[model samples]
Target: MALLTYTPEIAEARDKGHPIVALESTIITHGMPWPQNRDMARQVEADIRAAGAIPATIAVMDGEILIGLSAGQLDRLAQTQDALKLSRADLAIALATGRTGATTVAATMICAQLAGIEVFATGGIGGVHRGAELSFDISADLQELAQTRVTVVAAGAKAILDLPKTLEVLETLGVPVIAYGQDALPAFWSRDSGLKAPLRMDAPAQIAASHRMRARLGLPGGQLVANPIPAADELPSAMLSPLIETALSEAAAQGISAKGVTPFLLRRIFELTDGASLAANIALVRNNARLAAEIARALA
Candidate 1:
């Protein structure tokens, strides 16, 4: 009956009822350049540990659904090329075949739920792309949040996405989008995306209490905690908006559509911003790790 498996560390944490936060593997295998990616992965895990929780960075390898990775696994993953980016639909196939794969936001949530982890932390979630209307392209993360009962703390949807539409879809799915200590939603690297969040909660205890309430009320899904990047790390909407526009224009010109849009835009944005975007991403992810730890501790 146990279709999925966990690493020893994660299994022990689960047995001990320790506070554990789930991290996606895509950030290591696909998010950044090597060495930096491995370093950032360790740093985020350390941040969670410092905040009194264990980190479970989920991935699939050698026919096992690895709930946490060792240093060697992380280093190898970062250096390995063409790691299959697995999502909800492909998660089982990857595991069954023993293929090495990185977990996206949606797949990570599923793994977290399977591991009995209540919270997840990540840099930014994938969402509605710029041309969703025409291309019908949207990220499965939105629907995943609406069904999985794991609270996710993220900076917000990536700025390259259609922010307003993504928010709309989350609302339609009845997902609670709570901005942490802020009135407006964050736009990944930016402090504010100029759109007001559906709800706001300042304390991790309050967020934890809300998670309990969702269970009490028999809610199907989880909450979206949108934490803004720190002022010093924020790229500001002013800078990001134009860069996003340029990236979208370039994508349009090249006819980059569907699944290719996100990676294409992110690569172009990295070049356009001279790596500032990547830096901000790492900062926000660590920040989310800290908050997610607090929530997990409260849940414990």
Candidate 2:
């Protein structure tokens, strides 16, 4: 039996050799409220189309890995209240059980690779949690990047994580972290992470070339393109830092751990920022979709 299925649009694109950008479904299922999540998914897909690439929003449904989602499928997934959040460790379980699930960054990359897609876009990639030294609760997304071959475009690692530690881990895993058009890594909602990026690329073609070159050199992992959120849309790191600390404190106090921690912190930050965080998240995701489209085109 075929393990992967494609939407009509993606199937046509694949037949025609068109550029395609992979999108994670967790942003629709777990990142936002229902109608807004559906709306945002539509806008991001549109953004990819506008940039001349097809969008393949990957998910698992009815025991198959969906390479792309139709409007109805996206809507249904967005409204699902108990969708499993599948990562590398359990993506197969979700498929085997005939479950509805949303793909995390790791799972999305895996699906994209399986579908022969080369680029993925998201608001941000997960990273080392703040207390990972003790909890050892690093996100599987980092390890996925260390092995997966799909180039990821994002604002950067989620700012709520320990950015320095995340960078160290990426380095240790031999993952190339390239800041797009900047020397400093972006911090999700913020433009500057206050740490120097090991590599900087000024154009999508450059990124695509580096990606191809890495494969030629027999490198195991994909390159991370740390695309910054627009200055006008950024929350400013100074303002976000204190709010992040407070959210982390609240999560710890409430005994939130593991998968619960990120969503809890993001919701709290949204509340503390009076919705600015969500707005920034939407902006960054759209921005990444556009850039990923460009990279996909370059690769094609």
Top candidate on lDDT is 2
TM-score for all models, in order of appearance: 0.97, 0.99
lDDT of 2: 0.93
Off by over 4 Å in 2: none
Candidate that scores best on TM-score: 2
Each candidate: what lDDT? 0.90, 0.93
List, residue by residue over 1-300, the lDDT tens digit for candidate 2. Answer: 898999888999999999999999998888888798999999999999999999999999887899988888888899999999999989999888899999999999999998999999999999999999999989999999999999999999999999999999999999999999999999999999999999999999999999999899988889899999999999998999999999999999999999888888888999999999999999999999999999999999
Per-residue lDDT tens digits of candidate 1, residues 1-300? 366677787788989999999999888887888788999999999999999999998888766777888888888888878788889889889887878889999999998898889999999999988778988889999999999999999999998899999999999999999999989999999989989999999999999999999999999999999999988999978877888899899999998876667778888888999999889888999999999999999999
Candidate 2 local lDDT, residue 227 = 98
* lDDT assessment of candidate 1: 0.90
